[model samples]
Target: MSGQRDRGGYHRQRPPTPSSSAPNMSAADPSNVPDAASARSAVTDTSELVEARRAKLSAWRSQGIEPYGKRVEGLVGLAEARARFDAEVQAAYDEAVAAAKASSSSESVDDPRDRVRVAGRVMQHRDLGKLVFLSLRDHTGDLQATISKALVPADAFELAKRLDYGDIVVCEGPIGATRRGETCVWADRIELACKSLFPPPEKWHGLVDPEHRSRRRYLDLHVNPDSMRTFTARSRTISRIRRFMEDRGFLEVETPMMQPIAGGAAARPFTTHHNALDLELFMRVAPELYLKRLLVGGMPKVFEINRNFRNEGVDRSHNPEFTALEAYEAFGDSGTMMELTESLVHRLAVASAEDRRGEDRVRTGDEDGPILPFGDLDIDYRRPFDRITYEDLFERGAGFSCREIDRVRARAREIGIDEAKLDDWFVVNEVFEHDAEPCIDPARPTFVVDWPSAISPLTRAHADRPEIADRWDIFIGGMEVGPAYTELNDPDVQLERFEAQLRDGGDDEERTFRSLDRDFIDALRVGMPPAGGLGLGIDRLVMLLTDRASIRDVILFPLLRPASEAGVE
Candidate 1:
């Protein structure tokens, strides 16, 4: 890799001429350099473009150059390389080059620009006879690389001209700006990193279809900059959440994703069979029960952020498999968990606001707090989120008290709910979900508390109001973020609730999955302390924070039907 300084302050590699021994290095081979028309036709005729790339791949190998390169050190990101460009240094070099040219001197100008090595997928390529310009994209962002026929080796220059839109390549050059003021890497050396054989998406309209984006996330990440930013934010947010919990004296823990009985929440579970034990196991619908077991085993404050699988329908806010954050604090009630949830959510919202609008632009105070947009609504995550009792909300929305079972049933039937098949409390909940939940302002985070004890089997009933469980669910942007419950630690009461739940199973499908966790009851008998438990939907939280419309957008790979079944080509 011997080099000389170019007029533009770039360390130029000595150009090599093709010898008789290297027949594949022939720069005159038309198949080796894809023309503009062939590149543009890739979207319409993928087979031709793929065949062309295959030919180039073979040509590189025949020239004793591996298309898939080995590890090289000191590789800088595209964004960082672009940032390293010094306008003053470039201006000085340009002036010196102009002076030498005007004097008819053969001496080369001293090139002092910062040198860098960068690698990324080729997103855009333009061949202009002696100069080839390429836009390369990495996860950080995109930067342009300029290759001059006089600077780099003949083989490297030929490789640059033949590069296809998804092919990854490494470039070593001085960090400088093009004549048009576009920041770029003035490459004197280029090497193929990975040869992409498949044709890429249309240049102007890349990977726009939602189904395709979700199915092929790798392509989506490369083409869609917003998707990359969203996923990066999601990763950072999860890490911040873990740190927040740890700072609050909570220990992060892991729980089993498979359970003998899906006893956490009332959701259908995906079942699997173990070959050695010859027993059926169910994917955990929630980590609630297992987390509670930790409380029994003397882990005073513990939390888990992991996947939960439910055999359920998928929609804007629902995914069959999703991430969740579940935590429990010993001797704390629903109020304590509510405070924790509110604080954690508020902190995340403030951080998100700072990221969106610069830190100086974020406003403060009670009334003017950090506001985040979710679809048509602007949600405020200020402290002291609105609170309302479930009964009060039901009364406000249905125009009657939920205690009036007959009126509740009538409202349920009026709203197209099958009141005849549901229990009294269940009928109340149906009306509440359909009519009451929407009464809360979409722009404000609200907690609907004191749900009926019958509906909250694992929650402790309030001492004063035996029928009202000490449970609260937080809703933001018209979506239920999570729920907190004062846990039921009494073995006798828990057993009774479990039995009642089994007796009240509405369908055979529900009955098949619903079972008593006798071991949990036994753990309770071992003298577990009263605790507050909360479960937050991580995917939905990300959707709200990132302002994404659907859960599928935030999820890297959401479940979908096969291509044939989905009617996709």
Candidate 2:
């Protein structure tokens, strides 16, 4: 027989039967046990498994035990408990037990191993008549728990014998190694923490369908450890961002989600009606206007990490509602924001690389910086990212400058773009996106600055070159991560720009939501300081850092079609 260790001591032989005073509970009835045939069938049939679990639930109640137990205090995480295991103490205890057994003495040897209380969902269970082994899983990782019939009370032993795969339980015992050298918690006390009525997914093959994973995120998070780690990393990344901003004197603030005018960006907004004021409001597409309002209120530096809603098409890189980081710095230009963004992204990439390698492999001044894989490409986020003017890239790709309207029109038509209906600058941008953007090295982060003034309505034009706006966009991993702009704070220019956007031709749907924000113009009239503004897609950033191929994987609960529409039961 295998030796067992207890809090009081270690014993080579079977300990004395547990006393009757252990608990006022009856033994499990033999008649309640399922036959071999039925037990095998239950594994393949979820309904049968659920019925079998319900029978065990009733049996637990008959024994004067609550399957849904009360709160258990002093419980440590399974990972922490596993880390506290001491090999030297276990070896010493084993030596003493062997010494006592050789002399044929009945005295117990003092055990020196650490004891821990842990709670987790049972992922695997094996009943060996006298000993039961269970693999329990929590967010951190999985750990094994061994239950000895001779160590725990009769009722607790019986409960351990009948534990289902998904049942949550709390186990308390000393940490020790098995005779086979497997580290486990030799549980002396076990109690059911929660009775899982529904049958879980198959133990070996969990939920594999992508749609199902997103629809039932709880099960996805439970069965898939990678999903859990991705979200956990995302949370840590956001926290690090907050600390970084705070350290740089950027005050975090919250702004209105619903606004009378969605004037921040040129995107369709979700509309809602307020009964109290009988007013129509649009969900904010971006918090740029509000964050700028803070600057007008005398806040030197302000940032907001929050949700923005836009009524738009959904794709791998776009979601109707998404998280974004918007920051504004007073008395700064696009150059200032460019440096800040470069530093922030580089640091995040370095941290992510360290996490992947399980060590601090890269540092700020390291000659070979961190390189993370995104799909098939390895993105190198070294400092001083590649930079080029927008017109220069356009000329490189299209073989003509953006100022040459006839050539831009010719290239737009060659690319099947409707150049006749669109204006000259619009055609130029369309051609640029099609022919020029792809010319960039997808593996290297690059910033394209000096955008045309017509495309960036809310951006300040260059002092010498009024036709070019002082705006820049950073692209990485073939995706435009974000943009920074020298904000237009002059009230007259701001109002004129807003009117021009409204005058630009659009469908009726766009016309309905497009309206001027006189209040924002008034805020600019309050003598707001010239500032630089930035907008970053948090979901895309997480996707890049985590090496996730889709934006939905980063978002915990991405929008999905209804079950009826999606043909899912």
Candidate 3:
């Protein structure tokens, strides 16, 4: 990939054309780069933010103040800052400050300002003669800080006045309340924490541009407190999941992300070359096969919570890469995995409700799940999630069970499934999606079980019912969150499934890696214990738990195009 100049003056990797850059437009007029002329021309650009910060930085520097500050550790969180507030203490303190100013002869006097140290990005600042008010924000939350000239040293008070919003500042102050009862730290000592060279996003709307927010999430996180909370909740949710899995005795393990064959799922791989080894490697689409292999290797139980790369489209729900958790147990079957998935998701929902404030969880942002609002519907992740077989759901949705081939085909035609041309399974999936999928309560984390054997290549078929595979997909908020599979330990059966998949037009590239899982079979031939496996979409889970509508929101650095940035030659 070659680097191309983006609109943000950042280098974005583009198709390898040539190292040559787009001719420097700035060479014609360096002064135009940050001038009002350029700014008005592209007011949409974040450079407007940069320019604003530059002006503020200049003003502060002219006043002999550093726009960027020094190292100041031991910053207290907003929640902690709020804890220091005391109504009675603050009233007395305010009186003390008033008296100190009025009593010129008063030599020694008691001051009631709360003495505490905290550091944060300056979000809001107001200086009123002998007093200053500021809003300090950190990952935990935000609070107001007040500095009175009479309380802080003369130099410190001056520093407080010179402080610009977005600058990092550390202040030692007494915790008290403003007359309005807003919790505030009364500053006695102030120090520069760190200088922000760039201007912040719109203080009111913050970083509202989706593209910019994704590109410079660090800026978004600081500017938008809600963004920080979303990410923080995502982390805590993952942490809780790990604890849940571990408590259930699932041993976590790392697997080879680079594989000779990306055979586990029907998704494109991110291919890369190992120059030294001269071997092609693929970013795994799923850790399913490896985790299953671990079960075969006598690991008894194993799980991998990691990433899977799917070279696919970008949408509200899709990303090129995303996190997943895949687990396998030696003696469990699909039913076991089903139970585990349900309990896990239920626990997550309960925990999220507990962690969130207001009605976001209980009311739901979406109408699909429980009463807990999802996008618009309250997603109900409550226990005993709805369960319906593929046939049952299809029958209800298509007005005929999947077994009613003729009607299924007719419905498919009506739905543009082209049943007359495609494979039986393809047509089945088509109607299943448009029709059957809608039958499940999107608000309920429901599982549609027993997929058609053709689509579930790796899943085992019910002995009594070879037409239906022992598999299930769990859906919530109109998205498939994960799937569960009963183990197929018979090598001969496994080989048959693989061969049938190839015969179905999965060409050479796929066969090379999908080739009969001989080693897996060998393990099965060793009389391995039957097991159930589960693969979960961790990012999507985070999105649900954090109430982020798009998969991109929960993701830290979703891939994006670098905006064209102009610069001086």
The per-prediction CA RMSD against the true structure, in angstroms, equals: 10.6, 11.6, 5.4
Residues 1-569, candidate 3: write the lDDT tens digits.
01221332322212223553433335344543343333434544455556766776676678776656666666677788788777777777677767887887566657665567888789998878888898998888888888888777787787788677788888776777777888877777877767676666778878888778888898989888778888988898888889999999989899888987776787778888899999988888888777777776788888888989988799988989899989998889899999999888887877777666365446322333334566876777766889988888888888876776777788888876657777777787899899878778877788999998878878889999997899999999888999999878777888777777767655576555444446666766766678898999998988887778998899999977655443422
- Ordered by TM-score, highest first, the candidates read 2, 1, 3
Residue range 246-267, candidate 2, lDDT tens digits: 9899999999998999878889
lDDT of 1 at 163: 89
Pick by TM-score: 1 or 3, better one = 1
Q: Tell me which of candidates 2 and 3 scores higher on lDDT.
A: 2
Q: After superposition, how far is residue 562 of candidate 2 from its true place, in Å?
A: 2.5
* Cα lDDT listed for each candidate: 0.86, 0.86, 0.77
Model 2 gets an lDDT of 0.86
lDDT of 1 by residue, 1-569 (tens): 00111111110111223542333432345454433333333334445666888998999999987999899899999999988989999999999989999998999988999999999999999999899999999998999999999999998899899889999999999999889999999999999999998788888889999988987798899999989989998998999899999999999999888788987888999999899999899999998888888999999999999999999898999999999999999999999999999999999888777667743334433337778877887787787889999999999998999999998888888889988977788889999998899899988889999999988989999999999999999999988999999999999999998898898754787997788898988999997899999999999899988889999999999998844412111
Model 3 is weakest, by summed lDDT over 10 consecutive residues, at: 1-10
